[model samples]
Target: MTAICIKCGAKKSFPYNKCGECAFDPQLAREDLVKSVCLSSGRYGSQFEKEKYDDELNSYSAQLRSGLSVEYDQEEIERLDMQLTEVEELDDKPIFKYLLRVFLPGILLLLFLIGVLVVLKWR
Candidate 1:
């Protein structure tokens, strides 16, 4: 059966072949688009690049909410919102802050283990 692809609005054999326009499978159109956009917008970039990505994300979100194509999937919309929030939050944090948050715990744990090993060896 041919149906309109929710992501690209192309008429194709639904649930079988991918959309020729966006290369998205009809069964998972929304998911494919959302994942593609989120993956393309990685966490690290220049300030100007991040701002550009933020604008793109906002545009996609608005398009989804605008109901231009098919009925919007609430779950997908929420996922996009969460991703947007995460991207914005990461953009605000400094590189040092991010590095510390990611690696400080491991460093502290290694120090504690070394201290324990030293005490054991002396004993």
Candidate 2:
């Protein structure tokens, strides 16, 4: 069987990674994976690139969990996992969501009740 090189589209032998043109090394790839995970936003050049890197990591993790023949350094994988968790935690929802969804509705309801009471007092 054959697998497409991650760096290049060339089809190559499975478990080998990369093609003759790309000259990919497993250790170097592992280092890059760790770097990609450790860097903050835009480290890969743009938000799209960063998301692509995350998607690649997630896909590889799924492959490993699915028992694919592909292999990577276990230590590197562990480090990547930790870095991903940290990044996710840092991406918590913005405060605007709370203000828009919860605070605004409550504030509007309070104003409506106040208006009703003012009309009753006038009567």
Candidate 3:
């Protein structure tokens, strides 16, 4: 079956593995481009030029990762973070102070009342 591009609504065939135009998936192409860039990273003239190339490559890589994330998946994040040089681990602890803000007090009061009634009945 021919797969259609959901974003652009373009009909595409995979007989030879891609559409002839637009290239459709920016994310997939970005991977190949990164590999070629990394291979040529040390070929720059000056230290400044090398740093500039590396910075631009890093930004492009970040953009590629962000752009490709169409869904939130914890396992996918852990997998990606395992190999990435830069990733901040987020704190998972709850921010709110746990005040007894609901029915706990009411439940305790009812329990006390029931106990008092049972004690009076025993007398």
Candidate 4:
């Protein structure tokens, strides 16, 4: 079996991550995969890149089971946790239509009063 090298498109032997021609260590290789994350919008990145990133991570095979620390920020993770906790209430709109209805009458009344005053002054 053969696996394709992601950095340089070349067919290489499997099981052994290091290329015969280019010695690319899997640990160091992961840093390159970080680029797949499109942090611009802080949302999901290119699906194709994300797929490739997952594939490359899986390519290590054994590494997944043992666990690896990609060194994700603890603060950022906590912030995301807080965000997830708040996510449930995100859908619930706080605006009450009654407030607008009440406000509209007051505004209309003020405008009518001003309009009456303006006409009286004009006369």
Q: Could you tell me every candidate's TM-score relative to the true structure?
A: 0.26, 0.26, 0.25, 0.28
What's the TM for model 4? Answer: 0.28
Q: Which candidate is the best by TM-score?
A: 4
For model 4, how does the per-residue alpha-carbon lDDT over 25-113 read when each residue is reduced to its tens digit? 43353333222121111222476655554454444433423443233445645554455447635644345565777698999999999
Task: Give, for candidate 1, the lowest lDDT window spanning 10 residues.
Answer: 35-44
For candidate 4, which ten residues in a row score worst on lDDT?
Answer: 35-44
Candidate 4 residue spans exceeding 4 A from truth: 1-45, 56-61, 67-71, 94-123
- Candidate 2 lDDT over residue span 26-119, tens digit each: 3365554453333222234566766665555556545644556345556755766676568756777566676689788889999999999999
Hey, what RMSD does candidate 4 come out at?
A: 15.5
Consecutive 10-residue window with the lowest summed lDDT within model 2: 35-44
lDDT of 1 by residue, 33-108 (tens): 4444332334324767666655555555455445654445567557775776687678868887989999999999
Clashes of 3: 0
Q: Model 3: residues >4 Å from true position, as ranges?
A: 1-99
Using lDDT, rank the candidates from best to worst.
1, 2, 4, 3
lDDT per residue for candidate 3 within 14-65, as digits (tens), equals: 2123433445452355342222223223334487776665555454434444
Residue 123's lDDT in candidate 1: 100
Q: What lDDT does model 4 reach?
A: 0.45
Question: Would you list the clashing residue pairs of candidate 1?
Answer: none
How does residue 34 of candidate 2 score in lDDT? 50
Ranking by TM-score: 4, 2, 1, 3
